[model samples]
Target: MATDLVRAFVREDLKKSDVVAEVVSLVTVLEQEDFRKLLQEFVDGIDQSMLLDVHLLNGLVQLIRNAPQGYIDVDDLVKILGLLNTRLKDTHKQSTRHTYQLALTISQVLDSMVDSQVKGLSREQLHEPLSDYLEELKQDQDPYLVYQATYAY
Candidate 1:
């Protein structure tokens, strides 16, 4: 039921910003098990689509930002980071407006994690991949990618 609510919101023709806000609101009230299921569904959705929906990405960021300490464990963080890395690489060769949007959203998600100081997430685990991702983003010709990379740096 919780996952269905999220899917319904995602499928709605609402504005991207509105979709994100709605998802965030819904995510905040979900029980831990429900949240985990939603996250797994999100991972599966990305695996099948090979594209990260900006609304969903932003929603997840908000959830991370507002979640209680220890709500998101290390394993969950790993999955989220892995998904971000994959999307970054998958979109690297494409310089469309959508890809630029994805890059900016990715930056926001990363920023939220840092600002929240997510429990059970270690610097050692974050350092290498994040460094590599930023380095790659810095090399992009797109101004938005450069700005995001710089902001993240």
Candidate 2:
């Protein structure tokens, strides 16, 4: 019941927020070691096959994108980068797109805090796991994602 847990977690009074402030609060939870176990539990609670769907992946990217600057702690980075590495290594095109969008958002953090990690990155140099995600977005079906690619330039 990974979906169930994700649903419960997402529906928690904790997950509902469009503003960056609320998102930062969520990121704080991710910074805690307990959050890793919770996330694995949440994923394990779901049907493994559902991992193929881009919706869940999309939601994850959205979550990271919504995080506030300087709040992306190492634990949070571990979760985000690990997922991106796994999805991209498998050559999941659409899944990679979601990651790219996440990078684009982070790169635009006004202060460019994520820039050194994300720019012109190779798969091996993915300090932030930047390859497949950025590549897919740079050449995406969505214009906004495309626009987002150049925004870094």
Candidate 3:
């Protein structure tokens, strides 16, 4: 049932982008085995490239960061983080506001994971892109961006 629902969401033109987060929410309170299968099905069914968009990637990252203990498997979580890293590679060209949003999202996710007992990407893995974001943020003249980066850094 979860697999079918996930597939349906992926097929829906308007809802496809929301699939990652919805799946995360659905499986949060489920058993580990169930969570693993649902997440594996989701990962296997979606095109990896679709996650390269920052909006979708943000949803996935935030979901993993905020989800409960059984919501996503380590392998799937790693794959999502990898996608985010790939998408964020050239983010320096984006506006400060955009960079700040991305950095803040990643930072909040990292912070949430610390507060939760859920397991997913290691701190080392998330910090790589964050470090880059902080470096980029350092060059921005906007005090808001600087403040956010400093707080997140």
What are the lDDT figures for the candidates, one per model?
A: 0.65, 0.45, 0.56
Expressed as tens digits, the lDDT of each residue in 1-153 for candidate 1 is: 666776675465443667557666776677776666656655555556644566666666677767666667756666677667667667746655655665665676666566656556446656566667678778878787788777765
Q: If the candidates were sorted by their TM-score against the true structure, best first, what order would they fall in?
A: 1, 3, 2
User: In candidate 3, which residue ranges exceed 4 Å CA deviation?
Assistant: 1-3, 13-54, 73-79, 112-133
**Model 2 over residues 1-153: C-alpha lDDT tens digits?**
333443456455333333223333354445434344444433332225334434344444444455445544544444445454454445555654654544443344322335326443333655434544555557767777677655643
Q: Per-residue lDDT for 79 in model 2? A: 45
Candidate 2 residue 147 Cα shift, in angstroms, is 3.1
Q: How well does candidate 1 score on lDDT at residue 41?
A: 55
Residue 149's lDDT in candidate 1: 77
Can you list the residue pairs that collide in candidate 1? none
Task: Please give, for residues 19-127, the per-residue lDDT of candidate 3 as tens digits.
Answer: 6567666654555565555544444433344433444545545455655664554555446445445445555645665666655655665455455534644567665
Q: Rank the candidates by lDDT, best first.
A: 1, 3, 2
Q: Is candidate 1 or candidate 3 better by lDDT?
A: 1
**TM-score of structure candidate 2:** 0.40
- Model 2 deviation from the true structure expressed as Cα RMSD, one decimal place: 7.8
